[model samples]
Target: MTRNAAFKVALIGASGLLGRAIAKELAGVAGWTLVRTAHSRRDAQSVKLDIRDAAAIGDFIGRESPDAIVVAAAERRPDVCENDPALARALNVDALRFIANAARDRDAWVLSISTDYVFDGSAPPYSPDDPPSPVNAYGRSKLEGERALLESGAKACVLRLPLLYGPVLDWSESAVTSLTPAIVKSSAPLAPAAVMDAWAIRYPTFTPDVAVVIRQMLGRHARGETISGITQWSGDEPMTKFDIAQRIARVLKVDARLVAQRTPADSTPRPRDCHLDSVRLEALGIGRRTPFDSAIASVLARYPEPTQTLKSQ
Candidate 1:
């Protein structure tokens, strides 16, 4: 299908951090009819369709018969998924499986969003072909979600992502953004002291960059090209969470002190470092990777300055 064919596309989770970026990226682009859906936070502009509801998804797919479906919805928090495995599976795995099956039946394609947490974080810089050994419930559920979608025998692509940050309605929308307030809350605009896992490594991804990558992949798919199976995409630099926090403080011009603290001896077992090697996407010539600092600057530039600084805890 050419771009001029006016390809019908369904984008789930259009109100989310990444989803919102993707929606904006695709906006005003010719030859795409976007059908957006959300669960409870439905805006007047979006359709209310719970991904967990299989029958509703099936009905929606049948009615819309979109040429492609992009799944950006999931129960993404690790702690939340760890506490409620079933809900994670329902949202992360079952919903994707349902979409895959329905799209297959209609000869449509799927682009399912996945996470880098599929790895156990023991290894450094995982490749696209690496065997996934997720340590947490969220990772396991998402890995299964990937399996379900790819094994459904549909023309699908699973883009494994890293920790994402971007412009959002609030800082709580992304962990990276949530750390910003901690820095600027001091009376003297000093960066607040925030504890970070010194040993854990992460490659932060900007949502706008991810959106561009997805749009490129979708464009390829629309042009009857093969951009299927699993691929890794992330920012260029690899840094620890503490490093990320410090970078945030630097970019925001806050003198926040980011403490490099190791994970507690008795704390929950989380992946130490799941740095994804994004060579697959690079080889395919399909990503707009921005340097971490520049990306942070661009994202923070969008929002207003911080409000009255609150007393640090």
Candidate 2:
């Protein structure tokens, strides 16, 4: 079970934004077999499993008995988490606990996705060892999940990332890409300008790149090297949502009138800047940061914009 030439892995939350990217990455790997799971959003490729249910998680993990487990399930919306901390804790904290504890029996390596929100944006660049001071419900729940895994005694790695944008079935799938609709709407004649926040700085990392990092880490683990504890991966670009909107407009080749709100207007308090240093993963030679503009273009290409948003040939 420890060192197999090939690996069987279970991917929880396979129907979500990050899960889809990870599923695609695992599909392309040579010697990896994946059992993808879905909850509210069911798909034929994935089995139905509500990760929030502890007994169900135990039963599923016990029956499937995979060599590794990747947890992508989370209530990532800061606003939603702020409004309903209970639901956030249920998925982000409790579900992760069930997973980590279940995996302990099989000694399966557990890789759980975490976020930059764990740190209060004041820090310029946070390291794995940096103490976390989560400012919002979302961050607190995720940090608790990380702690739960650590306490579970299962071989685990908490991979923390920043704002992510990549191939999306819809723009709203990612916080960074969600600005597209408003930016596109602004292109119409005499349309109201699309205003974005210039206050909070975010490093928009690509989901596909994160997926590759997981693959690399799992490959290393399968090769008999134990990859445990906390690690981070993120894009080096530093831009606000307003700046990101402009880039999205540029990719659409549109003359959109976009406005930037210099002040923080979110109901939920946001950290001004929480940049994560990628040195840890970079040292291991396992990470990628596709240029923001180019990556955005690729994502936009996969999902076409409304006719009004497209430029004339």
Candidate 3:
């Protein structure tokens, strides 16, 4: 089970939401050592390296000599990707290619965090074999990244997850939790109602749960298992932003003036419903779907805001 040898994992985005969660989960797990890396938000525990630089990635991997790698860094914002395709490709596609090739040289397993956006949300529940038709640059770039990693001939597994939320330094940390500040501001007297999208359906998976899943996958690999290929995990509860905001309001105990936009209204085209089938992972017994209500409540408690109402200023 490789218990006699030390297992080192290089976490490539230790400052981001999912990265932080993975770091925490792996911290307490016995027989796993973490070498964390960051780019924009460099920290003491992390070694700062530009993912866009192939040379830097190669050097870092050579020096660290980790047994496995977990990549969480990316240009995740859809709008940012939409506005700048080049930047998106550099970060999402090119950087991943660098890491994959480097890992292949070391014969190290690579688990890359991918998104459900690879599929245009047309089909109800897409399996790993389903065709990908990304609607936006973000999705397209990420899909390309998946290809780059798989094509590198590395011991790689692409774990695709849907919308994510967790404990945040700010409301804007997560698209799901970002609704909080808007809910709070709109709930104040004399403010316009917050408009939330109700057209697109999404499953907001929790990060810590995902972290646990990644750890389980790592353990499987340690015990001499084949883990390469595309795997997906997601929260089962489907809700749009409007549905999510309503739930957030309830959690905050506020009466937010929230308006529902029922039609497709995003400037960037998004899939109507991109529900990823987790049956594969379920069969392997490697996933967790935290109840959204309880999970969101935990997030709010950690980053609680001032209670607002319709009271006059």
TM-score of each: 0.91, 0.95, 0.95
List candidate 1 segments past 4 Å from native.
Answer: 1-4, 186-192, 264-267, 302-313
Q: lDDT (CA) for every model shown?
A: 0.83, 0.88, 0.90
- Candidate 1, residue 65: lDDT: 91
Ranking by TM-score: 3, 2, 1
- Candidate 3 Cα outliers beyond 4 Å, as residue runs: 1-3, 304-313
Clash pairs detected, candidate 2: 121-273
Expressed as tens digits, the lDDT of each residue in 139-251 for candidate 1 is 99999999999999888989999999877676777878777776566415444566666777778899989999988888888888858889988886888767877887787
In the predicted model 3, the residue pairs found to clash are none
Model 2: lDDT to the true structure: 0.88
lDDT (Cα, tens digit) per residue for candidate 2, span 44-99: 77889998888999989999888899999899999999999999999999999999
lDDT of 1: 0.83
Measured with C-alpha atoms, the lDDT of residue 278 in candidate 1 is: 85
